[model samples]
Target: MDTLKRDVLSQRVQQVRPSGIRKFFDIINTMPNVISLGVGEPDFVTPEHIRQAGIESIQQGRTRYTSNSGILELREEIAALFQRLYGLTYDPLSQVLVTVGVSEGVDLAMRTIIDPGDEVIAPDPGYVAYEADIIFAGGVPVPVPTYAKYDFAVRAAEIEAAITPRTKMILLGNPNNPTGAVIPREELAAIAKLAIEHDLIVVSDEVYSQLVYGTEHVSIAAMPQMQERTIILDGFSKAYAMTGWRVGYVLAPEHILSAMLKVHQYAIMCAGTAAQEAALQALRHGDADVKRMHDDYARRGRMFVDGLNRIGLACSEPRGAFYAFPYVGNTGMSDEEFAEKLLFEEEVALVPGSSFGNAGKNYVRATYCTAYDKLEEALIRIERFVKKHA
Candidate 1:
């Protein structure tokens, strides 16, 4: 019997597609000398000071599980940092739940609010996990497509149009993945207003909140009367280059937070003690490291976007995050074809836009999270490939 087939897996699990981002990388892993611009992760190591804190925690034998909600000290710092950055406030004891990563927070948020038939509206061409998370939680994921013409910002009208009586929440990633578009304050306010009108909860995934270049990141949670309705998911991974640390947190109303915590306590017990200590240090003293990395990313963003245009791939200037989503339709190849051909021909690996959503079909997402010299080399190869194809 093929036990893995048909009835073995949950229907919801089988209904969701595997992550399109990892599907290609699985192949790339078997190839040699490939320069991957496919993954959205900071190539930098965790800052020395932060690493030291984690090491110190182990040395001091503080290796036990923290409170199910997380260490109060870390939660307090997170609350303070949110207030400082977005002018949002939360009671550390009741409103914050430390998570394994923003990924876990995403799952927990969906599961907490989304009953079997509930709907959650999110941007199409968003992070791949958004849809899968909603589906796994037994909720319907309604995607509203954002376009390159509009710089990929999710419009309030599009979101409202997708809403039904079934929609219980709105999910957003500010400083969006794949596209690197940041929501403007005015537009965010409009969306918050719509959420309020519809009585829908908002889950604002601000993992890349600190990575913007010229523009400021506006938290929808900070809008008038929106704090109680918006759930903020953020962490040290992106800005601090601490991906392996696996530490993130969610901030929401006490009731919502408590329900999420109930799931988290059973599913995770607590985030790693060492990581929590390290994250506390990051919140307290990692400003210099964050600034240094952001400056470097800004330099690479300008160079990469300009290089893509020069190579005949029309790309909008990414205002935030470390990716450049360029229109690759001129190459006369599908998004996946362009990516596969680029990998085989030039040893350069990029994520196909369709991996994010069908709305991204004519584009490709290239991450600038690597070093400058590596980015330059990748661009040269891309230019050569473009000439051959275009």
Candidate 2:
């Protein structure tokens, strides 16, 4: 009898690890009475107005496939958003692409720009998917460490040190996922200068742009000469509490956008029609809802981060997004061991920082996306767990 080989998958697919975030949630779901500070998603539902818009679109039978680039109105709204927010202009017709989500936008961007053997310089302790997407695009991902000493902010000097002749692009998430560190404008300008000197494109994932606390979010694309080489990736997931909506957009130079659209057209055809309609309403009338959610996240984030630090985890106050990356080395356990033991003993779930990259080994990412009471309760359990382990 001939046995079939199980190793027939593409070598690239085999090389990458599965998403570290999802694997933790799978365990959290099977357990009862668990307090999760795990997943980075809003606790709020999509605003009523946005939901109604989606429902109305469906009722109106606006379910047909849109132009491969997405409907004109949504693209126009996106362009207007860039103009109003960053003072950067993009043509709605040729320079914007609507993707299924920032996830898809990232994939499209990688496929569009990366050539075989190209090197993409990304920040470590960053998003888990950045390296995987680069590898899948047949590019080498060079990780530059972002240390807690520097508030986990990616620095231009670190990026410049990591660059090589093969380096082709910079992939970064502002208001970063695990650490929730937003890069300052001065540092961002330094990075832009590096990109220009090296002639590299910048893939800026600003998905959490609207969730900053105390400071306004700045887009690197808005910097002088940057619009010509930066691809701005953003979406409604974080701002509008539309994680399930799967709608996001890319603002890029026309040449880059056209190349990405060719890939998007074949890969996804178009984002969901109803989701697009909902996104339109989100852009037009969802401002108040976004502000409301942002304010709540700020409150929860302060309370939760304060609680963690007081409990001996030494969490830094994150400036943006809703995560608290706390140093758990005091627990006398590795990141994975601390997370695992806490989950089993205290019924509390947190993601191990090592899941992000080597640079995250000493920390753990705790999201404040849950309700205030739940966060407080999780902090209590975490405190007990740390005391017991210590």
Candidate 3:
């Protein structure tokens, strides 16, 4: 029976490790009064107007499946949003594809462009999905390590060194998870130049674009000669606090979009109709709500990062996103050990940075998306825990 079960599973599915973030979340569920700073989800509710739009769609009996590419109206809104924010033009009918979420967009982009043994270069300590998704699609994930000294920004020269004859794509998560490091415009331009020279595809995940502080979010696709070779994955989940709604879209050149749509049609059919409606509403009227949330996140980031540094964690100030990646090696423990001990001793939960990649082995990632008072308390407990270890 064991042999039969083993034979039933594909090697790829069996070999891909489960998400490291969820391991801590599962432990949190078994404990009480635990202040979790691990998950990267927004604490705010989806804007009221967005919710109302979803509700109205349901009330109006608009729950049938949309076109496999999604509703035209939502696609238009997505296109308009890109134009309005970054001055990037995408044809709503041919270049935009609605997906279940940015997760699906990632999957589709990988499978659409990668063949067996093709190589994709991505940052080390990146969003956890980047490596696994590449493996699942039968491609090789080449990780170029990014260091805290450089603010965790992957250098263009390092990326150039990693390129090989088999290299097919470059995957990027701007306003990166785990580190919250935003690559600056000049570095992005250099990367764009490399892609143009190498004839490689660039998959730019801009989900956190709107959450930046004190820096403009520049899309590589907006660079000269990039639109033809870049695939942009974005969604309302992060910006509008619509994580549960699971609506996102892809913008690529028509050829790439068509190929991705084929996979999306077969695998997902379409994103939820009401959710798409809600996302449309978010695009049309959620600017104020986004600004309100962005301001709150910026404030929270400042307070939390200051607290972490004050407590001797040596966290770099995150310029974007809501995470603080702090070096925990001074505690004389591995990141895993520090997180485990902190949880048990202080009832505070955060993810070990090694979960992201090997380069993050001595760090831990804490998110400040919790309420202000909760974050303050978590900081106090973390300080106590650090002192105890000291």
- The number of the candidate with the highest lDDT is 3
* Candidate 1 regions with alpha-carbon error over 4 angstroms: 1-6
Model 1 residue 75 lDDT?
98
| lDDT of prediction 3 | 0.93
| Tens digit per residue, CA lDDT, model 3, 1-390 | 435545677777886788889999999999989999989999999989999999999999998999999999999988988899789899999999999989999999999999999999999889999998999999999999998888898889999999999999999999898899999999999999999999999999989999999988899999999999999999988989999999989999999999999999889899999999999999999999999999999999899999999999998868788899999999899999999999989999999999999998999999998899999999999999999889
| Local distance difference test scores for all models | 0.92, 0.92, 0.93
Clashing pairs in 1: none
Q: In model 2, which range of ten residues has the least summed lDDT?
A: 2-11
Report the alpha-carbon TM-score of model 2 versus the true structure: 0.98
lDDT of 1 by residue, 182-296 (tens): 9888889899999999999999999999999888888998899999898999998999999999999999999999999999988889999999999999999999999999999
lDDT of 3 at 166: 99
Model 2 stretches with alpha carbons more than 4 Å out: none
Instruction: Please give the distance, in angstroms, between residue 376's alpha carbon in candidate 2 and its true position after superposition.
Output: 0.6
Q: Can you rank all candidates by TM-score, best first?
A: 2, 3, 1
- Model 3 Cα displacement at 93 (Å)? 0.3
Among all windows of 10 consecutive residues in model 3, the one with the lowest summed lDDT is 1-10
